[model samples]
Target: MGFCVESARVMLIIFNFIFWLSGVALLGVGIWFLADKNIVSYLEVVNHNVPNAYINYAAYILIAFGALIFLIGFLGCCGAIRRSKCLIGFYLFFLVIIFAGELAAGIIVAIYRTEIEHSVDKELSNSIKMEYTFANESAITKSWDTVQVELKCCGGKGPDDYMNSKFTNMSGIIIPISCCVLSDTNNMVAKDKSQCMNKVPEYYHEEGCKKKLIEWVKSHSVILIGVGCGLAGLQIIGFIFGICLCRSFKYEEK
Candidate 1:
């Protein structure tokens, strides 16, 4: 039993409505993530088929979490209207689950991020050496070419990274043409493929994909933490309202 049923009921409804909207925002963001040009392409590369595993999991997590939060918010609103203690209980249960999940995900990411990056680096280098066939043009080859051209980066490191790859090492080339400065990137027209391949300073990008990708990941971490904190604050609000409404319903009955 608790105090102020009437006020609690009204406030609970208002808060749940806001909660519902947050879910929608999450859903929208998740969909937007999937629609991002290069990000979507990166998401498709999972397990052994592709690298960038961190982002691959995040995409699914966002969509699924968004849907879950949407349902909880809807249930919270309904519970407040009917004064259903069971529904309120269910709402609190799920909110706790979500909180725990977010915490766990954060901890896991913090511990494993560097390890994951190293693993991906190894796999990417392996792909560049063996899987990215220059003659046959495997998926990895095209993907690497696209990454190099679009990101304006060279190999996993710099152009010299290709020195160990079969195609470049055997062919005695320093870098792929994709590394070259391009007048028309869409057409894959390098301004100086020969010079780029020969490691000319003017003809190619010096930065490595590994460094570029790490920076990209770091940039998104702040956004993720912001979103997580926002959701966490909302869930705390929900917990308060849920308890107030549940106990107040009992008090009114008594």
Candidate 2:
């Protein structure tokens, strides 16, 4: 019996350390996502178009929850090491709250996944039509160019999506050079000089950016869901260990 209690206490201590490290990682990711200049600028331009804009809110929540988790992990570690019933109880309370928050977030994402995709697609299309231009580059324009260049994609729906664009009409260019496939030897020169002026389908990416972007979002959302489930499972184990430790400590006192 004594051996079992000792083993449980050791496990609790190790779990708390891992939990603390996870909290730190989460905090760092949240900060990076919110503070990155390019991401911030892009989001600012589309903020009004995005529905509810809860993605930013989610980042804020992550930062706050990460801090709370770090504090709870510290308390849990001390509680396990010192066999303090009060601290262990407090840690359990906070763990339960974190679990509840994770559950709520998961539900919200599941419920509104379709609406979110629609909002993203619509805003992307609108941004491309209204704001995209190679000349007089703005943040939105830069963002689109970066996406096109990196993703090897054209306009939101297709190259023709830019048909109604003011830039296309004024400049008489069917697609930006960013959408073109430059040769290995002269990639930089071609991109810089707009050498791939040919608007033919053979010269540019055939697929659309909107579909690719949506697919990317969906893939990441799956990963996020998996991470959330893993965290919730960890919280459940932590709760069990906490209760066991608290009980063992009480039994010794009596």
User: Among all windows of ten consecutive residues in candidate 2, which has the lowest summed lDDT?
Assistant: 184-193
Clashes of 1: 0
Per-residue lDDT of model 2, residues 1-254, tens digit only: 67767987999999988888777866765686589764564454335366565546655666777788888999998888887888999999999999887676666546445656667667777887788775946777766766676667877777777887876876777777667875542253343334456655566677877776656545544644565677778888999999998888777766
lDDT value, candidate 2, whole model:
0.71
Q: How many residue pairs clash in each candidate?
A: 0, 0
Query: Residues 1-254, candidate 1, lDDT per residue (tens digit)?
Result: 34488788788888878877877776676677678766553432213444345554554566678789878888888888888899889989999998876665555445435655656677656666776556635666677777788778877766666777887756666677788889898888989887776667888898878776666555655555556668789899889988988878877888
TM-score of each: 0.84, 0.84
The global Cα lDDT (0 to 1) of model 1 is 0.71
Give me the runs in candidate 2 sitting further than 4 Å from their true place: 31-48, 183-195
User: What is the number of residue pairs that collide in model 2?
Assistant: 0
- Model 2, 86: alpha-carbon shift in Å? 1.0
